[model samples]
Target: MLHTLCNVESGRLSRVEAEEEFTVDQLAAKVGMTVRNVRAYAGRGLIPPPRLVGRTGYYGPDHVARLTLVQELLGKGYTLAAVERMMSELPDGAMALGVFQTLVNPWTPSEPEELDELQLAEAAGIPHDPAIIAKLVELGIAERMDNGHLRIPNPDLLRTGLEVIKLGVPLDAIFILLPKLFAQADAVAKTYVELFRSTVWRQFADAGLPAEGWPEIQRTLENIIPLAGQALVAAFREAMAREIEVVAYEELGLDPNTLPSTG
Candidate 1:
């Protein structure tokens, strides 16, 4: 019997004997995949071909790990082609699997919620105005379902909109500002994405991404998510302050010296 240390939490093996083997059916059962799927994966080079053992073929721990990783990636909305490409990018090892897992794990803190039309309207502090609801959908603030339910992708944002509405901001004015805000946000997002691609991803790609460097690449990605969020918020705060100051001076006829320094 070959010894294997399975980390049940991650459904990955921390350590396993290379010689530990299973037949296709057994391997599929162990990895929670269908035997046909296992064969397909082998056929497509998603998993390595089993070792020839006389008349039968036998797969080992590496196959198990790879299959588990594939299932994980697929669960996270990756297509088979994308998973194949991602797998090809990493060196073959358990560490690579762990790194990819971390890289693909959910980074956002919020989960989307499904709400009825009344609930959504209540959240937005708005009456059942089809035009306004359609506007919200267009803004990507909420998604309308075939069942006439609403899926709020970010409840916090919805709550913020309600608060703004409560503060006497006209719904029309809010809707008018959303597209401009979204455009600016899209541009900012592109800049950050390019920064990550040019810096961390470029270096890893150029270095050929040795197994030893996987942790560093993973760490860089993990760090970038929260850091990028912080940077965006800080920049927005500064920009908002500056704009408010200008409005106070120009439109409100307030003295520049009387306004607080945005800097």
Candidate 2:
């Protein structure tokens, strides 16, 4: 039988097989593990033993979750013994599963898109500059696939770069400025991430991350994702306005304070 559960991060309900049963082979297939590995995990006490009915054994959702968690931990370079200790520390069932899901599911603004060579060149307004394309790839703006196609990870950023190029900015100048912009953006991102880490995540950890509060914590993170962008834009505009005024006063000798008021 299929079951439904709340997707805490998106505030949407997702259908998961809560009570569905699986044979050892079915469980291995379901969790993308080999049967031998599944048996080893069960034998090693890394996961709970299946329920035996006569000659057959059945696995459930909790077993699937535990196996997934183990796989994720192993993928991250944790030893099997370390993974066992980590799982042993956490409370079973919903609490462990919720925490794992939260860690695995990050908030992404949008999906990446693939573009042909001609389309990428048109977007960047550099029709035949192999050097510019190389620079873009080096800067992590886009990636060149094995098939020679390009994948634009952040289309909005690419479009913004194209707009600047359309303003007659020299390619060399843009390339130099792009790295500085990225560096500054990285610093800002670190500050914002630290803010969230110190506040919300810290509180969650301090409270022992109770299962009852997982949904609320997830909702808070979801709300923060967009709100953080809005806040950054608002702050940047204000800073830019102040800096523009200062630059005009120094370079063009035009002081806004001394100008006659329009009113």
Best by lDDT: 1
Model 2 local distance difference test score: 0.73
Candidate 1 regions exceeding 4 Å error are 1-106, 255-262
Tens-digit lDDT string for candidate 1 (147-227): 989888777777777899999999989888878987986797678768877887777657655445657766876787788
Look at candidate 1 and give me any clashing residue pairs.
Answer: none
- Model 2 lDDT per residue over 29-120, tens place: 99999999999998878776778999899988878888988897896568998877666554456544665566555555567679877887
Error of 2 at 163 (Å): 2.1
State TM-scores per candidate: 0.67, 0.66
What residue runs in model 2 are displaced by over 4 Å at the alpha carbon? 1-106, 256-263
